[model samples]
Target: MNPTATALRAGVRRGVIELRQSLTNGADLWNHAFWPVLMLVVTYFLRDVSFGRTGFTVGALALPGILGMNAAMAMVTMSQLLTADREDGTLLRAKATPNGMLGYLVGKIVHVSGGLVVDLAIFLVPGLFLVPGLVTGSPDAWLTLAWVLALGMVAALPVGAVLGSVFSSARAQGLLMLPILGMIAISGIFYPVTALPGWVQWVAQVFPVYWLGLGMRSALLPDAAAAVEIGESWRHLETVGVLTAWAVLGLVLAPIVLRRMARRESGSSVARRREKSLQRAGM
Candidate 1:
């Protein structure tokens, strides 16, 4: 067998093990359920409220956007896990093995993407019941949903890996939440972006979050719903173009960044980081 092929198989096994551990562990299971449940509760309350004269409830309109936002958030999950792994010397251990970085990255992608699919199912299955006006019966709708999700992950995860490599510490990774939250606020996740100021709309369009939301809305909503969007269309081409650009950028950058970060990992450095963390915890 080819060395890379061997590493790939090991990576797949690593990812499956990690994903199973997450599903079976109490804390991880809670983490998976918490956000979706909270979002469902919020949507339930808003389900009765109308979105202007569009005849769609606020909750219905928000559901697909919420799904997209959560899918895009897989990037954050990948980033945080990468940082945690580095802090705990997992990266260092991988570096010591043959083609370990390749295996490690493949494993990370599989786990993160797999976990994302689970999270989406958690939200979408109940969401269909709780929210109205979603076109669930069409083959086209599902096809749209499938591509948006696949591309969205491709765009997000590599960028997330790059971010994780850059942050260097758990504390630093936490700071990333603020900007992400800010982006969500402007990304039309909870409301129509056309309603926001022109500058805000432009800023929102610059990122993947808005496009993801738009893509989801395109997938799940009625044709009339496009009237509420900018340009009165789904703009599928733009969505594909923007997300593909990000995917390319991230794919190009992640390896360079990860390799650089991995080069700096050593037994002494890992031990020092562990010592510092223990000291901070007063343990």
Candidate 2:
């Protein structure tokens, strides 16, 4: 078998093992449950809130967009985990092995992506029961959901990886969270993009979060809901085009950035980072 193939196989096995471990761990299990439950509660409250005279519940409208926002969050997860792994010398260890970097990347992708799917299902399953307006029985709805999610992940994860490679410390990485939150606020994750001003709408559209939310809303919402959107259509072509552009940019940047970050890693650097972490904890 090809060496790359073997590495990929090894990575997949490692990822599956880690995911299983996470499922069994108490803290991880809590993390898996908490967000879905909280979001479901929020959704329940919003189910009655009306969106102007459109005859749609504001809650029902927000659900799919929330799903999209959650999907977009896979980027944040990737960046944080990558930063942690790098700080702890995991990246350096992978750099030392043959195709270990590739294997390592494959493992992280598998782990994060698998976790994301589980999280989505958790949120989506209970959400369907709470909100009645969604097109749950339609095959097209589910299909569109799958493609948007899969593509959205593809577009978002690489950018997360690139962000991870850029930030050398956890402190520096933490700073990224605020801006991301701001972006989420501006993105159409919890509300309609068209409700915002024209310039704000354009700004939101530039980010994947907006497109991802739009795509999910397209999937689960009724045809009439498109009236709340910019073009009064799903604009599936624009969705695909924008997401593809992001995916390409991220894929191109991630490897180059990872390679550069990896070259700078050494035993001493890892030790220094660990020492600083320990000192901070002591303080």
Candidate 3:
């Protein structure tokens, strides 16, 4: 039997176990339910609020955009888990074993992706009932959703891995959130990007978050809703191209970055980290 293959199988099992634990854990279950429920409530209140008399409710518009943002957030979640693991010596231990880092990477992806799917369903199923003016019946709607989600995960998770490898601690990782929030502000997660300044639109275009939101809107909104988007079009080709580019970049960088980060960590460093953590807790 191939050793790497065996490692991968172990990863799969580990990821499945962790995913199940997330489902059962009280804190995890609350986290899983909270955002989606909040969004559902918002969607319900805004269900009748029209977007510029176009007959499309703001609620409907927000649904897919929120979905996109949630999908893109997989990157952040991956980074969070990775950084936490490193701080706790998981990364160092994984490095000591043959193919352990590979397995660890695979496991994290599985856990993140699976959790994302479940969260998406939690928001979307109820959202569909509250938000109307969507192109729900079209076969193209679902196909677009499927491919956008697939590309989104590929584009996001590996970049997250790279980020996790770079940030030294949870405090350092928190800095990443400032830029992320700025991106979300301009990325049209809750409103039309077309309403923002043209230069701002250009800035948003450079990131995957904008494209992810665009892709989701394209999937769920009616064709006429494209008028509300920049370029007055869905720009599916551009979305695919940009996300694919990001996917390629992330895939190329994650392994090299992970290897570098792992090589830099020693048992003593990990022990020091644990000691600091204990000291902080005692304080």
Query: Best candidate, TM-score-wise?
Result: 1
lDDT of 2 by residue, 1-283 (tens): 7999999998999789878988899999898889878988998999999999998988888999999999999998899889999999999999999999899988989999999898889999989988979987899999999999999999999999999999988878878989899888988777787888899988888999999999999999999999988989999999999999999999999999999999999999999999999999995
The residue-by-residue lDDT of candidate 1 on 1-283, one tens digit each, is 7999999999999999999999999999999999988998898888899989988788988999999999889999999999999999999999999999999999999999989899889889998988878899999999999999999999999999999999888878889999999999999999999889999999999999999999999999999999999999999999999999999999999999999999999989889988999999999
lDDT for position 81 in model 3: 93
Compared with the true structure, all predictions reach lDDT values of 0.94, 0.91, 0.92
TM-score (all chains, Cα) for each model: 0.99, 0.98, 0.97
Q: In model 1, which runs have C-alpha deviations exceeding 4 angstroms?
A: none
Candidate 2, which segments miss by more than 4 Å at Cα?
none
lDDT of 1: 0.94
Model 3: lDDT to the true structure:
0.92
